[model samples]
Target: MRNGKTIEEKIFKILTGVACYSLIAILGYIIFIIFRKGFSYLTIEMITQLPTGGYYYGGEGGVLNAIAGSLYIAGGATLIALILGVPAALYINSHLIRHKKTQNTVRYILDSLWGIPSIVYGAFGFTLMIWLGMSASLMAGIITVAFLITPIVIRSFDEVLSTIPKGLHEASLALGSTRSQTAFKVLLKQGFSGLITAVLLAFGRGIGDAASVLFTAGYTDLIPTNLDEPAATLPLSIFFQLSSPIPAVRERAYAAAAILTIIVLIISLSARFFAKRYSKSNLK
Candidate 1:
C-alpha cells in the first residue's frame, strides 16, 4: 500500500510538471512566432505615426492612433471599475462578514459575470446603446470594458482582504473604530498592494479584450479626441490587419500583436515592482 501511494504521488508530480512546462512552452512558442514574423515591421515610425489614407492598404502610417485609443479606453474602464469595485469588495468583507450566505451569493454572481463571454457584454452594450439612441463611441466601449473587469477587480481584492488576520479587524474595532473607518484605515491599508495588483490584472484584461469592444468602440484611423468619439484598440487593430488579403498588411498584424504583448508584459512587471515596494513600505 505504501509503494502504491508513493507511485501515485510520483505520478501526480510528473503530471504537474508536465502541465507547467507545457504552458511555458506554449507561451514561449507564441511569443517567438510573433517576434519572428513581426520584428522587421516593428519600426519606430510604425509606432509613432498615425494611419494615413489607404494605410490599411499598404500605405504610409503608424499605429499611433490605435495605441492612444487603446490606452484611453483601458484607462477609463479601469478607473470606472476601481470606483465601483473597491467599495463593493470592502462592503462584502467588512459589512457582510457575518452573512456568509449573502457574501457567497455575491461572489458567485461575480464569478458568473466574470465567466460570461466578452462578446456577450459587447452585445449587451450594443443593445443598450440602441435603446438609448447612442452611437458606437469610446464612452460606450469604456462602459462595456468596465463592466467586464469590475467583477474581476472586486473578487480579486476581496480575496486579498480575506487573507488579512482577523486579529487586525478585532483590534481596530476594540480601539473604538467604526466599521467604515476600520475598513478604510486598517483593511484597505493592509490590502493596498494586493488591490493594486488586482487593478493591474483587470486593466490588462480590459486592454486585451477585443470582443467586448468590438461593437462599441468603432474602428477609427485617428486618435479619439473625446469620449464620445469612435476609437480603436490593439486587439481589434490586429484582427483587422490580419483579415486583410495583402501580405504586408498581414505582417503588420503580427507586429501589432507583438506590440500588444510587450505592453501587457511591461505593465505586469511594473505592477509587480510597485506591489513589492508598497508591500514593504506598508510592513514598515
Candidate 2:
C-alpha cells in the first residue's frame, strides 16, 4: 500500500510538471512566430517617416509621427487617471466613504465601464468630440483613452491599497498622524510598488489600444503639429494601410505592424523594470 501511494504521488507531480512545461512551450512558440514574421519591417524609416497616400514612403520615414501621437495621448490619459483614480482608490480602500450607498454606486460605475466594449468607447468619444466641435483630434483621442484606462487603474490601485495592513494605519494614528497624513504619507508610500505597477499596466493598455481611439483620433499620417489637428498612430496607420489593394501598401502595413510590436515590447519591458525597482527598493 505504501509503495502504491508513493507511485501515485510521483505520477501527480510528473503530470503537473508536464502541464506547466506545455503551457510555456505553447506561449514561446507563438512569440517566436510573431517575431519571425513581424520584426523585419522595423526600420529607422518606419520609426521616423510619416505615412503618405496609402503607402509608406521613403527610407527611414516610418512611424515617427504615429509613435509621437501615441505617446502624447497615452501620457495625457495616464496623468488624468493618476490625478483622479489614485485618490479615489485610497479614499475607498481606507473606508473614508461614510455613505455605503454612494460608495457602492461609484464602485458599480467603474466596474460597469470595464464591461463596455472598446468600439463603444470610440464611438462615444467621436460623438462627444464632434459635438464639442473638435471633430477627430488628438485631444479627443487622449480623453477617450483616458476614460478606458481610468477604471483599470482604479481597480488595480484599489487592490494594492487594500493590501496595506490595518496595523500600519493604527500605528500612524498612534504617532499623531491625522487621517489625511496616514493615507497620503503612510499608506501611499507603503503601497508605492503596487501603484507603479498600476500606472504601467494602464500605460501598456493605452499604448496598444487601437479600436477605442481610431474614430476619435482620425488617422492623418501627418505629424501632430498642433493639439487640434488630426494625426495617425502606428496602430491606426497599420489598419488603414492594411486595407489597401496595393502590394507596396500592404508591405508598409506589415512594416508598421512590426514597429508597433517593438513599441509595445519597449513599454512592457519598461513596466517590468519599474515594478522590479520599486518592489525591491520598498521591500527593505
Candidate 3:
C-alpha cells in the first residue's frame, strides 16, 4: 500500500470538511448579520411601535399582531398537514396500498411536490384564493402552508413508520387485528417519537415560511378582525420590512429574523425533549 491512503481518500476528506465548514460559515454570517443589525431595533419603543413615518411615531405599536398571525396561521397549517399526511403515511406504510406501482407513483408525486418552490406555492395560493374570493383571508394562508408542509410531513411519518419492526406489524395481523387497529395500537405507539419529530419538522417549516404566505396573507397594519380578513405575519412583515431601503426597516427585519430563529429553536428543542425522554425510558 502507498503511504497511509490514496489521493482520492484525502480529496474526499477535504471536500466533506470543506462542505461542512462552508455551511457553518454561512450560518455564522447570517447570525452575525442579524444580531449586528437587530440590536439597533432593540429599544422598548422600537420593539413596540407599529410601522410609522421616518420618526416612528409615539403611539402606533408593536409586532404583537404579526406574532399572533404567524402563530395562528402556522398552527392551522400544521393541523391540516397532520390530518392529511399522517393518514396518508399510515396507509402507505400499513401495506394497504397493495400495488407497488400505485405506491411508487404516489411517493414520486409527493417527492416532486416537496421540490416545488415556496414562492410558486405562494403564487398558486394567491391566485386560487383570489379566484375563490377568499383573497387575503386566513383560509388562503392556511391552505398554502398546508400544501407546503404536507409532503415533508408525509415523508417524515413514512420514514418513522417504515423503520418500525416489520415483525411487530406481522404479529399484530397474525393475532386477528385489522390494519387500522394494528397501526393505532402497536406501530403508532412504537413510532410515536418519529411522529413527534415529524410534527416538529412540520411546525418548524410552517413557522419559517414567508413566500407561501406573502400574497395569501395580506399585510395589515391592524390585527385581523375576523378570519375572513387579511393579517400580517412575522415572516411576511419581515420580508416587506427588509425590502425597504431605509436602515430602520432593515434593522426591524433583522430583529424579526432573530425572533423567528428563536421560535424555531424552541419548537425543535421541545420536540427533542420528548425524544430524549422516550429514548431513556426505552433504554431502561
Top TM-score prediction, candidate number: 1
Which pairs of residues have clashing backbones in candidate 1?
none
TM-score between model 3 and native: 0.84
lDDT tens string, model 1, 51-164?
A: 889888998888988898899999999999999999899888888888999999999999998899999999999998889888999999999999999999999889888877
Instruction: Compare candidates 2 and 3 on TM-score and give the better one.
Output: 3
What lDDT score belongs to each candidate, Candidate 1 first?
0.90, 0.78, 0.79
Clashing pairs in 3: 48-62
Error of 3 at 77 (Å): 0.5
Residue 62, candidate 1: alpha-carbon lDDT? 83
Write the residue-wise lDDT of candidate 3 on 1-284 in tens digits: 67556877898999999999999999999878877777656666544555543432223355666777888888889999999988888888786535768777878888898899999999999889978978687778889999999999898778767667677888889999999988778867887787888888888888889899888988777667677877778888778777787776666667777777778889989878866665554311
lDDT of 1 at 244: 96
Best lDDT goes to which candidate?
A: 1
Give per-residue CA lDDT, model 2, range 199-259, as digits (tens).
9888878887899898888876577877788767777877876887776666767777776
Candidate order by TM-score, decreasing, is: 1, 3, 2
Candidate achieving higher TM-score, 1 or 3: 1
Relative to the unseen true structure, what is the C-alpha lDDT of residue 208 in candidate 1, on a scale of 0 to 100? 93
